[model samples]
Target: MKKIGVFTSGGDSPGMNACIRAVVRACIYHGLEVYGIKYGYDGMIKGEIIKMQSHSVSNIVQRGGTILKSARSTEFRTKEGRQKAYDQLKKHGIEGLVAIGGDGTFTGAKIFSEEFDIPVIGCPGTIDNDIYGTDFTIGFDTAVNTALESIDKIRDTAASHDRIFFVEVMGRDSGYIAIQCGIGGGAEIVMVPETETTIADVIKKLDTGLRKTKTSSIVVVAEGDEEGNAAEVMAKVKAENPKNEYKVTTLGHIQRGGNPTATDRILGSRCGIAAVEGLMAGQRNCMAGVMNDQIVYTPFDDCISKSKPINQDYLKMMNILSI
Candidate 1:
């Protein structure tokens, strides 16, 4: 393939610009023309692509979010829309492709490439860190660190007021952030979606702390936790005891912003270069990820369809440490 294109889709995450920069510079270093497709698949279908030079990605490594931007495309779900996107790529003389984003991005890349016979590779870029194959997604370290900083600050207020703070962290369907921040922030309890957790269980954990004469506590709750958001869980617990003060702080998109941490910058950059190399190696329909400090490739099907399970041992260790 003489030319290739790259884009970021779905939600914006920290370190994405790092990935974009690496892809562009790697392409130039390898003597292949590269184009940046703005707004992801939506941009591709709309023909919103532009040639990218080495300078196009200069000084963007520390930036959060993708320089190419991101958007969801319902139109790309249709064959007609895919056709238009294919025609647009062909118009630009693009051959192989690099996709950046989470499962939605991989699903689209998998389908588009298979249907059009275009070689495509992916780089995981979600802050949620839900995708399988990779130990951590591109923005996870930065996001977790962001939430941990908030939890640390909240702990100060909780101790002062003798209050229980229920801190909600981002991670749509995964508990990676909550579990990590919970342990790192020294939370009394953590509620995640991966394992069944009831409001009663949380109350029990809090009660255990209370019996120990603890004045204040932090409870980390994943946004997707089945027991509900931090606020909802706090309400249930408050109704049960009706004596303790409680507050809920949802980190929301703050975790998705800010400059990526050193770890994320490295991971994103590594995956970005690996993606270009994978495409050049004629490896199609896969994602490039770093595991155990080594780059590994996983098929898009596994990245999307396979379950990425959280380590229960980590949860157990957190519980042991909390009490």
Candidate 2:
């Protein structure tokens, strides 16, 4: 391909700028021209395409969020909108594409490639870490670490006041962040969407801790938990035990900001380079992911159709260690 396009869609996450930097440099290193598609598919239809040079991406590897920016385009889901996007690509002489984002981004790329006979490679860039192909998606480490740091600070106050704290972390449909951060933060209890959780179970755990004279306790709840959000869960727990002081802290967009961790930077860089190499190798409609410390390509259908299950062993460990 003489010229290729790259863009980030869906929610923004840390390490995306690093990925964009890697894609620009890798394409340039291979003597290929790169075009930046601002605001993802929406921009593609609007013809918001710009030429990218190595200098355009300089000093962006350490930045948070995406330099190209991102947006969800309802128009892109329709046949006419996709045709406009494809025409825009033809106008810019873009032969291949590199898409960065979560499941929705890949789904759109998969359909567009098949319809237009274009080669497209995907990079998992969501903080949710729910993609099936990779062990961990880009920005997951940074987000988990961010939540863990906040939980640590909350613990300090919980101990001082001798109270119970309900800390909520983001993970729309997955418990990867809540499970990992709960264990890392030494939480007394953790509620995830993958498993059923009840307020009675929470009160029981707290009652046991109180009997042992535990000065403080923390329960980490995933936002998508079956029982409800952190606030709803806290309300139920408080109703049962009116005498105990309770507080709720939701780590909302904070987890999606800040500089990426070393692991995330490395992962994003590797995936970005692999995406360009995959397109050059005549591979299309696939995602570049790191598995077992090696780069691997997975079909977009498999990556999005299947669900990535959380490790039950970690849940078992959490139970054993909490006691």
Candidate 3:
């Protein structure tokens, strides 16, 4: 019987458990032994393995975060650690691997698969939605929803205080979350890494809004932006308009944990099953992603080499809505 192992690496996302459940169920349905690798690549290096039964994964598709938990490991970046992971895989008689994570984790998996000659399938699970090949990564919808809710909450305070608040949302290199939340929540200025924005331009916009509108303005800034930290930008804006009171809030890991929204749950299930199917169909060193509403397997080499570009339509929507 074919033996398969699944692990979640890097930062944990909302739909990871759903992906794991689909992987395990799909493997079992196909008469393969499914093993859960705990703590991601670190767990593999440490030989942490658990055989998963159907009952073990029951009702986890609706859950947030990873059932196996997740951690980053510099050891996993080294050849020695990869050798240990290979040794553990051989000891357990694992024939294939399903890796769920972002770019960094996929890089490690690509190295391991090449070095060990083991088939590995990847499922994108980052909230950042920056992974290549996939139009939407697991947890992105949930993260956008979580961030929008936080913005709504902060809006209540901002309105009462007549304040301008700079809110920071997570997105390493992509601005998916920031754009979506800013648009959904009707922010005054949306700052994203995808587009360049000068402090002068932002101030002019905010000043116009303050002078013309009674409602407090919201500026949604992606963590990785040209203007630096959202908090510092808020300070500068406040200094320029000392008469206008403002506040700053940074939504960090909170965006990474939450019940997977309906879209995330469905996407995770589809992508997870697609990962197993890719492996069984002899698609080696590829990642499973949804394109044009159909599952497709992309070579890991291409996935690691480039990232999915930020959706310009969504950016346009944000701009229109902000206006």
TM-scores across all candidates?
0.98, 0.99, 0.97
Q: Model 3: per-residue lDDT, tens digit, 1-323?
A: 39999999988899989999999999999999999999999999999999998898998988898999898889878899999999999999999999999888888888999998999999999999987788899999999999999999999999998888999999868788988898799898888888998788788888877678756889999999878879978877766767777788999999999899999998999998999888898877889999889898888889889857777887788667766
State each candidate's clash count. Answer: 0, 0, 0
Q: What does the lDDT read for residue 194 in candidate 3?
A: 83
Error of 1 at 187 (Å): 0.3
TM-score of 1: 0.98
**lDDT of every model, 2 decimals:** 0.92, 0.94, 0.89
For candidate 1, the 10 contiguous residues with the lowest summed lDDT are: 197-206
What's the distance in Å from true for residue 109, model 2? 0.7
Residue 247 Cα positional deviation in candidate 1, in Å, after optimal superposition: 0.8
Error of 2 at 79 (Å): 0.5
Of 2 and 3, which scores higher on TM-score? 2
Writing each residue's lDDT as its tens digit, candidate 2 over 25-101 gives 99999999999999999999999999999899988888888889899899999999999999999999999999999
Question: Runs in model 1 with CA error above 4 Å?
Answer: none
C-alpha-based local distance difference test score of model 2:
0.94
Error of 3 at 289 (Å): 0.6
